[model samples]
Target: MSANKTAMGDIASSTETYPFEKDERYRSQQGLNGFAVKEPFLPNGLGLQVRKRKMVRKRKNVDESPFSVLCAWVVEHQIGLSLNLLLLLSLTHFFFSRARPYTSLFLGMSYYNPKSKKYTQGWEDMYFVATWIIIITGLRVAVMDYILKPIARYGGVNKPKAQVRFAEQGWLFCYYSLFSPLGMYIIYQTKYWFNLREIWTDFPTHTMNGLLKWYYLVQFAFWLQQIFVVNIEEKRKDYWQMFSHHIFTSALMFSSYGYYQTKVGVVILAIMDVVDLLLPLAKMLKYMNFRTACDITFGVFIAVWFVARHVIYMMVCWSMFSEIPHVMKQGCYNSTTGQMISEDGGTAVWWNVMQPFDRPGGTICYNNNIRIAFTALLMALQVLTLIWFGMILRVAYGVLSGKGAEDSRSDDEGEDEEYEEIEYYDDKIKSFDGTNEIVTRTIALPIEEDVNAEEMNLGLRRKSTSPTTASAPRRSTRRTGSARATALSIPGHSDKKDILGRIGCDKPS
Candidate 1:
């Protein structure tokens, strides 16, 4: 590839004027671009900025290069070439991987387990993280050197390794699948624990008896890791993306486990195993740097478990119980039989405050129609919605703020402005051998430049849908020599460590 560098340099030097003129106007007015990524805790130390690459657009129409007549065809229609390749790659990954699941998963088992309480499941857990590490993190130097570099042809048109992006995405999905369900259960289990405490006079000793203590420990460890993920680790990694995968799937799992353990009184062994699994969390916490942010987070965690756990869970339980007849019936179980004798199996707490008579079948807990439905609807809508919607609002805020970068730029031509540090833009690009011509591509963000820049370093692209296209823009001038000459390694220099290993280029900035 370096052999072509001279020719590419010649092409760059010979070009009359770069199509992308230096624009410094919006450098300081980075409301959308700057605000969305900065780590509130780290201040200026290590901000997480995402420079999105625009997409590889399908050609306006295939126009063969005029130079193609004189020499071998240099395919310029990236989109057309890309679409064809995507179909092939997609088919291969789908069918071939499915055909040899064990091989693809590095001898791991992948099955659905609803009652699982550990971060990593069983035998499948081994394969899940192992194959995931390979795909997302990429094969070690050996595989890339021997296999990938030899047979691989077109990388993504304007971007880097397409496989890296695809694999990373999949790895992240798997990570979320592994942990989020357990995390949700942790939160759900707390409800029953706190509720049980309300009725028991000796709450401390009562909550920590043989099996119950183990249950609480599993619940705490799983969710404590989650709280770490939600607030801190995600600053670098795709905690939310991982959370998203499990959140939807766990909705049912959490409810089922909640009903099973708290209402029906099972999940003891499952809870103990979860404790053994997450025992590593104690070590994991010491690995992170502690600061005021960490202090506040831990403080809140203590308050939630020790204080709020006692108070909030009870109120949440009582209120949520009034909503659902089946759950209410289930929770008020016979200690001797331990059977939740209810015909229905919706969430335990299903009441409405605004309209009491409008339960899911218009059914009432203990047949108290108007009163039951009203409380249930109110809890689900008011309380649960706040928990759910607050999450949605934060993500929406991140994405929307990033998109509105252009709108927030000021017109001051002479004012000096400093922008927050964005993370490495082209870190996705890896060194490739001449045997394998690496390529990268992203969908175009569709934002035309409306402002100027002060520094020559224009972020390849900011956060937008299809950012890869913006990374390596299409220059009108042609190259005179070997096209793949310049050795561009994705920047990996980070003053602050990326804690959880952020995933993918398309994450919300």
Candidate 2:
């Protein structure tokens, strides 16, 4: 009895001086401890799969459903999955590419072919391009994870969570670095740069070349992959918003492709992607602990984002709105060379559809409803882009003010540590008898904390501490002298019986 009392006294003394455990929990909750949050305890009804069935024996091997377990695993190991998917798809891509050698995947590929301007796409060609995207993206993820991360670690990049993020951003940097430039190059290859009127002037009869077709296809696949990547990986605060953005963007690409608007599509894509390259790079640098580099890059990214997404994108939208109405009313542009066709009636749909403005009677015909819908969707995209930019500005303000924090808006949601389920052994407390029996508390820490305190702490929030009040048992340990004695005697005292009496429970006589 004396030895146990002495041990309790020692613990009480230590608690009085410095409660390191409590401080650690507080630091982690503030994101200063670099730990994950605790997983929540399963509700009591969780044991009952259905409402009225006999409670089945809980499975020991796997506590969670397969789907949930799979989802959690995928969220933790996105890079590995991306790499695996890339490698597996690459093999399929190789075989398909060989099978469909010299084939064009786009329906508009024949537009530039003067002899036979008939749109065609073999399934093999489509599959090949898809596999190609998966492979390239996979390779990007793998290279960043395996190669770039190791190199960063060698250079003293110690933050594992940051390292994971660095790898994530690395792939984005690579993707935009390669494809954004290619998209621009494709645009430059066209007459759209010199003659903005050419875009809308072609109208419904416009077509895509092999290069333009492939660019749109690649972008479609890229964004599609992003949808999967973002969902399967740790979700951010803006998960649904970003998810919606991907959906809208992907829809735009598809709609534009269907409507044969690759010229404008490529231009918009190039503008958006070129600026996007900087953001991921900046984030990567920040994760690598290169604050100066990150700040510079981020500043540049902000400038570029404003210019590209706002100034230039809005300009393109305005041009489309003003010019397409005029061009559609006038029968304009030739098939082979894209030269202006006279008002007499050219084969291009712009001329053939209706000469509303240039009619003999001067009756102007408005464009079909499809054109209206496309423009509306594009306008909606602009609005969404504006909303996202506002979030970026907030993050930028934090960075510029020397906060040294990542965008709180985009921090991955599940990055914080989760506490493990609270497990109880039947023998620990025996039972609650509603008597003067002393409660012997057994605090069960999370299994994950037991395995690796640091590993589970990666980017996770700290567990909340028990409340400090007389009613709270957590505070009982802090009491000293008479206060401690009083707390210990409360269970047996009639006045303090109010604690159990409040719940309509009475002491066993």
Candidate 3:
């Protein structure tokens, strides 16, 4: 026992004069105590020698130009800047009548009629649409960073990747929750609420109510903002799928509004938004490690997705095929008068279709080409949703197999850390008697803290460390001979598999 204690003391003392002693580069790479080698010299001859290659530390050059600094500041405070701009515009519009027309173009509803209490779709609506995109972007940032992050921390979501995912899901939950109900309300008031055929009855002359118009425009803005968002945020395995979904969705909204199909547009929006609410809820619960809650929410999400996207939404698409051709008259009409012109330069028979007498402009028409384009866009969106549903079914299978749900498409957080190779002797340690000794031993050594200690301090690191075991455990006494031995245990060494398991792999699919 005394010999073993002396051997350990010698090893500890010898580490003080290690070849790379006090070398920051070595310490940074090998950890705080540097590399340790233990060899006890016996009275007889027993020797061991090890060689280590020197490592060079590379420093990154950081750009400190004024332009770079300004750009960094702008990115960091984008939400604040957007809010300030919005405030400035609101104040200008409220205080000055001369600026009202100009600022109202961005801040207020366009082509509004006070007598009828309605809004008309026009090119000028694009100004408000752009402004709302900025507003939604700012609101998303504020809600995620300020509201959801703190909630996630409180709920024990400590990993930086998990926290980010939680915040995203929380923000989406809020948006979808609010808008889903609003969309349903708008649909409830429309004649098409009971009859799907009414969607195309009046065609391009459907009355644009205030609630429906604003809902449609704001929804479009949100989808447009999402395109910028998905590109800026971390890229996932479903990057292209999400990107394409946002593109098709935004284009569909724009086309619907342009063709005066707000009635069907609102219905599709309501159906789509309903399913979105549950998915984010499930993701947020998963991030917080609520296993049961997440599983239950995921099940609900699957049901809603089928009902809303596959059943109800498909019905709307079918209506476009069966009802539109029968109800809508395809011909050139005067936008100024909503009068369908005959080939003889006279007004055609005044059918049951409503005339857009409220709108005065150039001639507009809804032809077969426009109908085909619209149908194709809607089908494209459906196909994207179907692809996502297939992914969901895989998750469901995982759950059934008792693996728990996980998002297979999500990428792992951070890059993998490379591990140094561990060399082994010829299954024996030679003794002073010149005979091979089969020694069973276990040694515990303090591992150097991870380089990202600051991130760990901020709860950004993925591992769950107990308060009592905050730092690495102290070294254990060395043992040799006859007892069964275990391999060296190193804490805080994360490989690619571990990282993937920590972040998205463990999430409910």
Give me the candidate number with maximum TM-score: 3
lDDT by residue (35-133, candidate 1, tens digit) is 222211111222222233322222133335776443222122323443554455446656785656545444333333345422211223334333333
lDDT of 3 by residue, 1-509 (tens): 13432212132222222232232233453332443233433332432221232222122345699987886676678799889989998899989989887998898778887887767777788899989988998999899999999999898888776687789889999999999999999888877886899988764563477777788889999999999888766666578888999999988887677666778888898999988887777667666656566656666777989999999888988988888878877776665446777423223222211223224454556666666777898999999989888866765554444443443455332222233321111112222222343222222222333233223232221221432122322222221111110011113321112111212223422
Please state the error at residue 195 of candidate 3 in Å.
Answer: 2.0
* lDDT scores in order: 0.30, 0.51, 0.62
Clashing pairs in 3: 405-509, 406-509
Report how far off residue 107 is in candidate 1 (Å). Answer: 22
The best candidate by lDDT is 3
Candidate 1 Cα outliers beyond 4 Å, as residue runs: 1-167, 173-258, 261-331, 339-509
* Candidate 2 weakest ten by summed lDDT: 479-488
Q: Candidate 3, overall lDDT?
A: 0.62
- Per-residue lDDT value at 69 in model 3: 86
TM-score of 2: 0.59
Predictions: Cα RMSD each: 25.5, 17.6, 13.2
Off by over 4 Å in 3: 1-72, 94-96, 343-360, 403-407, 411-509
